[model samples]
Target: MNGTSDVPDRPRRQCPGCMRTLVVDEQNFHKDSLCADGFTRRCSDCRNEAERIRYSLEAPQRARAKRERRAERRAYFESIGRYEAA
Candidate 1:
C-alpha cells in the first residue's frame, strides 16, 4: 500500500502568517474571492491578530484625526453663522 489512505480527501492548507498546516474548511479559513482556492492565504486567527495589533498601534492617531475633523467642521459651521450651542 502507498499509505496515502491515511490522509483525508480534503486538501490541507498552510497559513502564511503562522506556517501551520490545517485541513481546508470553512471553520479554518475565511472565504476570499481573489484567491484561487476561494479562501484567505492566512488563517482567520492570524488575520485577526494582525488587525488587533494594527488597531492598537493606530487607535490614538485615528482618534486624534477624528477630533481634528470634528474641530474643522465646527469651525466651518461657526464661521458660516450656523453654529448652535450644544
Candidate 2:
C-alpha cells in the first residue's frame, strides 16, 4: 500500500475569527505561516479581512515610500540633466 493510507484524515474545524465550521481541505485553507499545523487557523474570509486591515494600517507608510522613490528618481534625473519636465 502507498503512504496515503498511512495517514488519517483530519476533522473539520471551526474558524476562530468567524466561528464558521469549515472542512479542512486543500481548497478551503492555506498553509500555516508558523508551520505548526497542516493549514492556517483562520478561514479565507478571516484571512482576507486581516489582510485588508493590515494594508489599511500600512497605507500611509506605503504612500511615503512611493513618494520617496519618485523624489529620488526625479532628483537623479535632474542631476544628470537627462530628463525634461513633463
Candidate 3:
C-alpha cells in the first residue's frame, strides 16, 4: 500500500462566527477583495446571520444617521442658494 493518507488535501477554512468547517470555495463562501485569500472570513450563512442581527439592532441609529446626513445635505444646498423641498 502507498504511504499517502486516504484523505485528500482539500482547501478548508473555519467560520469564526459559527465555528463550522466549510470547504473554501465560492459556493460556501463570499469573495472579498480586501481579504488575504479574496474571500470573507465568515461563511455565507454566518455572514448573513450577522448582517441580519446588525441591521435589526442598529436600525434606529442607522435611521438617525441617514436623517442627519440628509439634513446636512439640505443645509448645504440652501447655503448654495438652491433651496429644496423636504
Q: Tens-digit lDDT track for model 2 on 1-86?
A: 56467667767889999999888866667877575667898888899889999999999999999999999999999999988998
Error of 1 at 18 (Å): 2.4
**Residue pairs that clash (backbone atoms under 3 angstroms), model 2:** none
By lDDT, who's the top model here? 3
Model 3: residues >4 Å from true position, as ranges? 1-9, 33-36, 84-86
Full candidate order by TM-score, most accurate first: 1, 2, 3
Sorting all predicted structures by lDDT, with the top scorer first, yields 3, 1, 2
What is the per-residue lDDT of model 1 for residues 1-86, given as tens digits with 9 covering 90 to 100? 97668765888889988999987778888889898989888888998899999999999999999999999999999999999998
Across 26-53, the per-residue lDDT of candidate 3 in tens digits comes to 9989999999998999999998988999
- Collision count of model 3: 0
Give the distance in Å from residue 4's predicted Cα in candidate 1 to where it truly belongs: 12
List the lowest-lDDT window of 10 residues for candidate 1.
2-11
Candidates 2 and 3, the one with greater TM-score: 2
lDDT of 3 at 80: 98
Q: Estimate the TM-score of every prediction.
A: 0.78, 0.71, 0.64
The number of the candidate with the highest TM-score is: 1
The C-alpha stretches of model 2 lying farther than 4 A from their native spots are 1-10, 32-37
